[model samples]
Target chain A: EAAVTQSPRNKVAVTGGKVTLSCNQTNNHNNMYWYRQDTGHGLRLIHYSYGAGSTEKGDIPDGYKASRPSQENFSLILELATPSQTSVYFCASGLWGGANTLYFGAGTRLSVL
Target chain B: AQSVTQPDARVTVSEGASLQLRCKYSYSGTPYLFWYVQYPRQGLQLLLKYYSGDPVVQGVNGFEAEFSKSNSSFHLRKASVHWSDSAVYFCVLSLSNNRIFFGDGTQLVVKP
Candidate 1:
């Protein structure tokens, strides 16, 4: 089975506070992604990385930034948290940036006040 | 650009009854389709996927999905559902370069 671990299962941040969500994958996948899940919006991609030291903007990258210091680690950063940014975040790793299965992390529930 | 759509937001079914969840896609080329299930407080799990060849593909937990290029749909089906089958189901479309698009998802409720 694929193993993707995310830190800080639940968090509450005040408005304008900085929030960081971390993810680590044991699958040795080359591609990693960060997505946020909302009630009606489902899951929208926030950021993705092809490999170490690479980050790309996703569908909803307005309020988030991503960093990939290594192949196994990916982090999503919220510079200024807001109430609208409150949602569950998920991290995923795939073998490559192609037609492959994605292994997902448990998820992080964030509440911005 | 590729997109996936799940028409139903929620569906309720009794245990041991059959179930079908609708999914539609908007893509010009051949699409890589997938069905994923998410339980409470957990990440999404792949239930099944379809790339090419046979239209019907089997998945874990006795679930299956049929891909219809004619109608641009990939609907999930189960002959008999159990209470454990209750969860959120998402239909996904994978485009080139590993970019994936997901539907809003359909919540399944199974009553015993």
Candidate 2:
């Protein structure tokens, strides 16, 4: 089955510390996305990439950076963790440029103290 | 700017009853519509999608949705729901800007 897996399913970080959430997909999709889920917000896009060596900003990309160095891996980085960044992060991949479907990872819960 | 609205935040139903989850969008063009289901503590999965051609699309697990161009609504329905059908239902509309916007989601509780 096609799958997107995220490592460090749970994480706890101190303020000002750096946190990295890694995602890997076996589907060999072209579009990768990072989103955070919180109460009332549903899911907000943090960042996305069209392919390796490309990253684009999303609706809520203010405090996050994304990297897609290879086709199978996409990473979301929090340079200096903040309490507000504590939420469940999900990674998804799609093959289509716009009308394609996204396959999502189980998600990673992050906490910043 | 595009947006999706799922009016009902929560809906409770007894098992074996019919169900409907409403979704409306603010796009003028024919948007790519989709319905996704998220089981408790699980990743979101695509239930069904409507790009064009048909107004009524059938999805996985006996779920179906009707797309109305005049009403700007795509409502999901199931003839009879099962206990396992209890999940968070989300509606998504792919916009011309190459982004997909989702509704707040409807939490369905199916009691046996």
Candidate 3:
């Protein structure tokens, strides 16, 4: 079974504060992704990494940055958090292939006041 | 660009009843379709997927989905509904270059 863990299951931060959401996967997959879930809009990709030291922007990458320092870890960073950024974020990892199945974390709920 | 659409926002069914969730996709070429379920406060889990071969594919928990190339649809179905089957269902499409798109999702509510 694939395991993807996320830290700070719940978080609260003030506006303009810096927030970092961490994720770790034990599947040893080559692809990692960050996504935000909002009501009515579903889940939108924020960022993804192909491997260590490689990060790429997804459809919604504004005000967000990603870091992949190792194959087991991927982090999503918000340099300046805003109330609009308050949402449930999910981390997923999958093997690189034609159509891979992504294993996801429980998700981190962020609240910015 | 590939896209997926789940027509129903929510569905209600009684225990031991039949269930069907509609999903449609838009893609020019061959498309890879998938159905996922997300329980409360949990990550999404793959229910079933269809790439080629048989149009109907079975998944865990007795969930199955049928793919239709003519309609560009992949709808999920189950013979009997249970309380545990209540969850949000998402239909996804996998495009070229490994890019995937998901539908807004349909919430299933089971009543005893």
lDDT assessment of candidate 3: 0.95
Best by DockQ: 1
Q: Which runs of model 3 end up more than 4 angstroms from their true locations?
A: none
Model 2 CA deviation exceeding 4 Å by range: none
lDDT of 3 by residue, B1-112 (tens): 5788999999999999999999999998888888999999999999988888999999999999999999989999999999999999999898657898999999999999
Name the lDDT value of residue A25 in candidate 1. 98
lDDT of 2 by residue, A9-64 (tens): 99999999999999999999988999999978898999999999999999999989
List iRMS for all predictions. Answer: 1.3, 1.5, 1.2
Q: Write the per-residue lDDT of candidate 2 for residues B82-103, one digit (tens) a residue.
A: 9999999999998645779989
lDDT (tens digit, per residue) of candidate 1 on A6-85: 99999999999999999999999999999999999999999999899999999889989999999999999999999999
lDDT of 1 at B74: 99
Report how far residue A37 has shifted in candidate 2, in Å. Answer: 0.4
* Candidate 1: share of reference interface contacts reproduced: 0.76
lDDT of 1 at B110: 100
Candidate 2 or 3, higher TM-score? Answer: 3
TM-score: model 3, chain A: 0.98
Stretches of candidate 1 off by over 4 Å are none
Candidate maximizing TM-score: 3
Please give the TM-score that candidate 2 achieves against the real structure.
Answer: 0.97
